[model samples]
Target: MKILYKKGIAAVCRIAALYFMAFLIGACPVAAEEEQKTPGIHTWADLQEAINESGPGELITLTGNLTALSSDSGLMIPAGKHLTLDLNGYVLDRNLDSWGEFGSVIQVNAGAVLTVRDSSVSGGTITGGYHNNGGGILNRGTLILESGRITGNTVLHTGGGISNDGTAILLGGSITGNEALLNGGGVCNKPKGHMTICADVVSGNQAPEYDDVFNQGTLTLQEAEPEEFHFEDMTVVRSYMEELAILPFLVMLAILLYVVWIDSYLSRERKRIMLWIVLLVLSLILQNYTEYRMSMQVG
Candidate 1:
């Protein structure tokens, strides 16, 4: 009875924590003076107004992607404060009807510190005489991209997918299938910033010259190994090599591991269980540090 009660309380706490996290991902920690723009709820003028009106140590949220094309508008996050720009969802093709030529899906002007996550940018078409610097994302400050897709965009200059001219760090995500008419098809990392593609892909991006794909950037490809895991108290086992989903892998692994470990016909095997446990312990040691390092960098 005591154990059952304890389990019930733990479950309730876990659920409450999850809800709290969902609200706080882009909600609190920012100063009250900072303004928030829920593009889904507010107008472009409202978003820009809040950004300009926000004081230092303040932040502005892009509740969703800003299709502020050629509006000559990308958000500006002031320095000295932690300005987190949560892309909440996808930022699609720019609004060409708004900006004539000098437009970008996103342009973080100089001297700002910004953090973006859990979002994407795609289908950017800049037809006017002006250039589309970054079809997806353009940064001139401190930028961080965590866990999402940045694909299928065309650019004329650096970072056909993304261009960071100041200090930047890309911790984990896909940087592929973007086009550069003149420069880097995937990324043009200038300035003193560094890009570490930890356990990710930098493939399938296009450049005018194949040899001209990468220039003036340092790429450290620290690939992560497949995780060895068993699933959901099931019999199967699954291992993930690249960017595979978690729940599916767990389901498969449970089935496989059960088959290898148990049998109604076979007597209990102490040796086998011990061997597997030792292997698991070693894997935990190796993987913990790698996962920790990937999460710490600012990209």
Candidate 2:
């Protein structure tokens, strides 16, 4: 019975060590698959259909300029959906009728989330012709502007560039060359709105009341430097760390239990000591490699 018990403990330790190594191997980054290119959106119908069919948090990129028709009111993002539009140096312009009448170029419905960014350094433009209000964008949901140019939009009432009734966060962008006859040539934060401008260029806007911005709700201008960690890079590192963190603790616990429960057997067994050393060394190597990869990604 003593011999059988000793064999069972040894097997358990071996199994634990194997599992530890397996987990460490799993933490290594897999070779990325060839990415499939998302087709560009050209026509208004295709654009709206893509938005309607897109899942939450999906990214849609533009390859060419798109102009809204006179019959079209605006591009509407429905509630409860989150979408990101990456303008790859393309324009989103609103087409005006002979009378130069049109609605806002884009309207974000309440309970939705929209992020507008430019993949190219020159950035993309969101401009419009004459409109009643919010010539460029009328946002009632959450809006995140990472990088883009909102310019050359003229409005009769307010918000020539952007009308934010919900939450708006400007991480890096330029809001300029927008004109409002009444107020808020660059941006308008309505009564229930909340806006935070961290890094943005707001100038060359003309308004009868407020030249650049009109705020009735809460508005904060941080004017701070950009954050070191980007979302995409951080996500990859975080997932690997979260999965890899548990294996070390389990391996140490197994080693501890083995030492405590069978000290005499462990001391007599040189093989067991070597096995522990190997596992520790391998664990250290894997941990260092993972950390190095993370540093490279962030740096």
Candidate 3:
């Protein structure tokens, strides 16, 4: 009876060992997958593939600067995907040459969510083409800019930095050194889009119509001071003529100086000299008053 009991115990131990081994073997692949990290993207093709094939809410990290190929239309985040692009202090350039005349640098399609942070979008000098708008980024879905730089992009039509057609939330970022031929050198918010800027993030942009931003849709500046953003159409304290008149004022002052100091007849004419001085003083007063009003409005 003792020998029979020892055999039964040995059989139970063998069965338990087998079950433990099976559990480890079944868990090995999943553990390995969990331990593996996705490689950082280094090339444009690789980046595009990652953007296209990534699952929703996947993170794509850039390992280096990437420039689009000549034949590429552009990188696009497809509809219904949510992706976060960590620029990793690198750049996503559309091109350095004339290839940017074709398509935008990045297009976030409708129903997609893209968050760009910690990098630069400073290439893509776009020119005459069907894709003249949104040289840096064309966002039709939801875009969140947490931090980074959008600079040095040139577009023929509008939105040299970014064109928003859906929703854009700018928490922090610099949109500078971008140029648009017509309007909205930094950003263009379209008629159907909604944009909210919660920080001071735009400056040094160039356009004939609007220097920093053009808002045809809804623009909410949450807690942003009036002096923080320069909008051509929305200056409350000054008109366009008032802004442009500074140079003419300087020119007139120069003429007055020449008449008072250089021209012999005007220099001797006390009444004319007094008249010029009075006019100069009045101009200075007007300029000062305009600036004071602007400051009050800002305050």
Off by over 4 Å in 1: 1-41, 54-66, 69-72, 78-81, 96-100, 119-132, 210-213, 225-299
Model 3 lDDT tens row, 204-229? 99999998899999998866643454
lDDT tens digits, residues 1-299, model 2?
98999888877876775676566555543322112223447787678888888786666777688988767667888998788877767788876532254477788899988888887877798877567677788889988877889888888888888889999887777889988899999888999999887755576799999988899999988767435313342223544665676576557546754554554545546656656665675666566556644443321
Cα-based TM-score, every candidate: 0.49, 0.64, 0.62
What is the overall TM-score of model 3 with all chains considered together? 0.62
Can you write out model 1's per-residue Cα lDDT over 18-78, one digit (the tens) per residue? 3543443333222221222222325555565665565543334444444443434544444
- Clashes in model 2: which pairs? none
Deviation from native of the Cα of residue 270 in model 3, angstroms:
99
Global lDDT scores for all candidate models:
0.49, 0.73, 0.67
**In model 3, what lDDT does residue 94 have?**
74
Task: State each model's C-alpha RMSD to the native.
Answer: 15.8, 7.1, 32.0
Lowest summed lDDT across 10 adjacent residues in model 2 is found at 29-38
Off by over 4 Å in 3: 1-40, 96-102, 119-131, 224-299
